[model samples]
Target: MNAYSGHTYKFTKEDNTFSYIKVHIKTQIGVKNLTRQEAVKLAGEDPDYLVDDLFNAIENGNYPVWNVFVQVMSPEQAEKYKWNIFDMTKVWPHKDFPLRQIGRLTLNRNPQNYFTDIEQAAFSPSTMVPGWAPSADPMLQARMFSYPDAARYRLGVNYQQLPTNRASVPVYCPFERDGFMNFSDNYGADPNYVGSTLLPTTFKTTKQGRTFSTLTEHEKWAGEVSSFTTEIGHQDFEQAAGLWAVLGRDPGHQDRFIGNIADHLSSVTYPRLRVMVYELFSRVNKDLGARIQTATEALIA
Candidate 1:
């Protein structure tokens, strides 16, 4: 997820001059893994096992926590950064930009009602507040619009009116007058469209090039800040190489990554798909490519 925000994010000090940053969250207990065999068995026999484990832990006052840390890169550094910071698959190497401890995240409370609180809950990327904004990552930008559009369609236009989705503070809206299932007095007949003389709206000064007014400035900011999709380059593999090295630090992780990928590749059955997968991985690294090909062939055979 931190890979999605690789742009040099802003950091302000006492004097107000700022630098850019990226954040990483390392769980205190470290990452846990399940073997392919174990995962398959669990999925068939106990699909909710993981959820039960989390709930039981919190109920017993054993909260799982993650140490949040950030990597700082100045605007000057970002301008001259080797790889495009907007790419989601790439990470800012920790050696170049070190982690600075910021805070901790704890899963303390479970939802009271799964349907009302969890199932129906809307998690829009546009939900972000000020000081914390979205970067130019294309995937992130897409999610900002896509997630809420899904929620509004799935949960109705007044989905935000749900007890779980409702804002804690008084949410004032002059434009959202009515919809299919509106319940908020329809904004007392204020024109849903602009040019209303009764309740004059105050529009914020937005980033240049945006034409959509219904969306918040933050949503517009996300689109303006990102890079367009284009051709791939060697730099894409650089961070993957570093990640492969990190995966090697753990026993059997590198093997598992290969075997796991091979297991899926075997399911493809098509010779062309297998060849494409092999070629792609080979481009990532020669050893990974060869191993994946070997493992995949063995599985298929």
Candidate 2:
């Protein structure tokens, strides 16, 4: 059972030597949860509770950080993997592909201007430099197109011109000339298209002679995209069941999950939707679905 928005990406080197990779960020502090009662109390008493907690920690020099991880399945591995590597919902089990910690991202510095710095900053997967690339997760592939389209609309075509979103190094784009708020001398005398003597482009080459112009059949997936459907059976429930088993290992997590879901599901007046959710859960574990259904019905009544 796989659940992923299939998006395609390529990871390339200076000589255009590349591999396919999917990236994940895990919080160093691990996941934390608060009860509904605690959340309500915090909301009524101190709406800025989370922000305050974060600020206090940083100010006291207890910086929060995240562990950067990548689930790197090579082209060969991707072809023979049990589950679809492109599926987002299906996680690459750490047992098989253990995490390789590349670096830490610390939130040590707070922004001086929340608007110009944080609010106006445009983050897009497409903004990645040469080394990092997107994977063949459909959702990720779609975001590559959607994100920049949004940035262009929301912050203008020259959104990259904004100080917060601008790259540290200079960016050249002869084609991106004459948009709203156009201030740059748009590539002075460079040619926009290829085969121009005005500005000839030379690509970097590796010692082994691999150049940027080379393309492999495996890299492109044979041009036209294909759509295929698969049957979902026990494999789909395996992960959810494993999650339930782990929750059982913890004395109260299963109850907590049921209670949390019930609290929100009770507000949804549509009975059929509630039944559908329970039916979906029942496929994973009969007891869990029953427990959640009972709790949710009681809440509604």
Candidate 3:
């Protein structure tokens, strides 16, 4: 599967200056997708088809590779951009923000143990190396907290102590000790309290003034002050309309997309709700909404 960093992030330097970036990982072998009919057949016949294929590919030495690229947007550009940089639903057009090749990722090996390596794995967007930090994306901010909290609930409080979840570099947090499945020496008699004189702990040092960049006045004014609400407007459908135009360029792709959506919408029993769905899509494109409604109603009948 192709991987995308939907949430924008920051790449900071020792001077505390930063640039906003988003990552794209494209398969080196090129993208190949199964048709809806083939996908359905495989789902029923071999539920673990994808996992099996990936495992076998690596095991047989034909490792899957992905070319990694990053799209950078300066803080100044973000402030003046027409679209909100923090909106995960939107993307930076390649013409404006070109992709810069950063690196390659290769799935060279399989998991040694399913339980230890695969089952116990816990990942969070908040888990970042130095010089990397999160942006003001609302959904990303929520996920950063919720993901780790979920891991704590599902994998126990000391989930980070697990082999798969443990950081490669040293982490010095004595306060976070003696929880469920804590296998470490619990800091080995080190003082858990900060600014302890009895037992001193050395922390990894960074350059002075290398703090995460502060939000601009515009960002500060726009973020996190209102109660949550579900509302829709014409502006929201602008991106959807753009996507429809993109699909139109791909010949039968638009037809397949409509058919796929109709197959799912046909199962909706509520007549009013189905109408609402169609109306919402109508905001995207009139023709698209009409086609979907006709196809869905035909299937339901």
1-301 in candidate 1: lDDT tens per residue? 1223433345543233445567777878866768999999999999998899999999898998988888876656765777656666667777898888989889898889889889888987677433455555567667889998999889998888788888886666665556676776666755667664765456632234332233322334444545555777776677787788888997899999999999888999679988998988887789999999999999889
TM-score of each: 0.80, 0.84, 0.89
lDDT by residue (93-134, candidate 2, tens digit) is 768777676667788977788799988889887776645656
Question: What is the C-alpha local distance difference test score of each model?
Answer: 0.72, 0.72, 0.84
Residue 40 displacement (Å), model 1: 0.4
RMSD to the hidden true structure, all candidates: 5.3, 4.0, 3.0
| Off by more than 4 A, model 2 | 1-10, 13-18, 189-195, 202-216, 220-231
How does candidate 1 score on lDDT?
0.72
Top TM-score: which candidate number?
3
lDDT for model 3 comes to 0.84
Question: On a 0 to 100 scale, what is the lDDT of residue 3 in model 2?
Answer: 19
RMSD (CA, angstroms), candidate 3 = 3.0
**By how many angstroms RMSD does model 2 differ from the true structure?**
4.0
Off by over 4 Å in 3: 196-231
Per-residue lDDT value at 145 in model 2: 90
